[model samples]
Target: MFGIKFFLLVTLPFVLRFILAFSTFAPVAAWPVWSGIKPRNSRLATVAEFFNLKDRKMAVDASVWVRAMHGDKSAFKILSERCESDVRLTEKIYWKLLPFVSRLERYGA
Candidate 1:
């Protein structure tokens, strides 16, 4: 889920554009998306089925990502509080930066 946004909004644009341009024999639209210019958007629920987090690191990161990305500070705070007693691995700053996270939220995208 975390990498999905970066891969879509950041990586895909550059990488796909390069490949499409280089492979002059083929067109970008041949890919699954309307065009290789962007990622194939899907519901969060559907996507969730695929992002199988393996351990505590993945869980914490994904938890922070899903919560922070939505500006759900209440949930993040609750999670953070729980972390103080047990994990202590996640930092406070990771819960901030709503503005940065907002960029990744493409509703209906």
Candidate 2:
């Protein structure tokens, strides 16, 4: 009977304290309330779009160019070679526009 009383005195407080501690932390352990919040800016949306798997190829190309521009020669070389054909095409179109713009300016003058 004395051992039983001693056990209750020692273990009961610990068990109650444990339960209280867990209950106190229960709300914190539950899902975060801020998890559903999203940014109102379109830039965040664009970043999410850039991370999509469907845009992996473009993302890789853009990342390479960004790395190269940041002084990574190897990355730049890889990006430049990968985009060389498209870059040249764009340059051609841009150069062609220059002469037409000059002609327009001369006519306007």
Candidate 3:
């Protein structure tokens, strides 16, 4: 019983980490939460890096979101171009960026 516990304790984290590291699946959605209200700091500056995916459209959308989070409005233009190239990408991107889209509309950005 002790040996089984030791094995699981040592190996479980490694197994889970490996699966997450290699997984190609993107989350259904992601959002940039406020990091803090520190002086001289932007509210949404410290955002997570977007995932790199194998699918071209998804990859582009992820990249665009990362850029957008960094205050680059041109990222949306690239996303739109990708959507124009593939109609299906529009639906996928819409869901993926729903939170950010709402924020943009709210702020009139």
The candidate maximizing lDDT is 1
Candidate 1 RMSD computed on C-alpha atoms after optimal superposition onto the true structure: 14.8
* Over 4 Å off, model 3: 1-61, 88-109
Ranking by lDDT: 1, 3, 2
> Which residue ranges in model 2 land beyond 4 Å of their true spot?
1-62, 82-87, 91-102, 106-109
| Model 1 regions more than 4 Å off | 25-109
Q: How well does candidate 2 match the true structure in TM-score terms?
A: 0.23
* Model 1 vs. true fold: TM: 0.24
Q: Which ten residues in a row have the lowest lDDT in candidate 1?
A: 91-100
> Relative to the true structure, how large is the alpha-carbon lDDT of every model?
0.44, 0.41, 0.42
Alpha carbon RMSD to native, model 3: 13.3
Model 1, 66-107: lDDT tens digits are 787798987678666655633322222222112123234367
Residue 59 lDDT (model 3): 41
Q: State how far residue 14 of model 2 sits from its true place (Å).
A: 82
- Give the TM-score of each candidate: 0.24, 0.23, 0.23
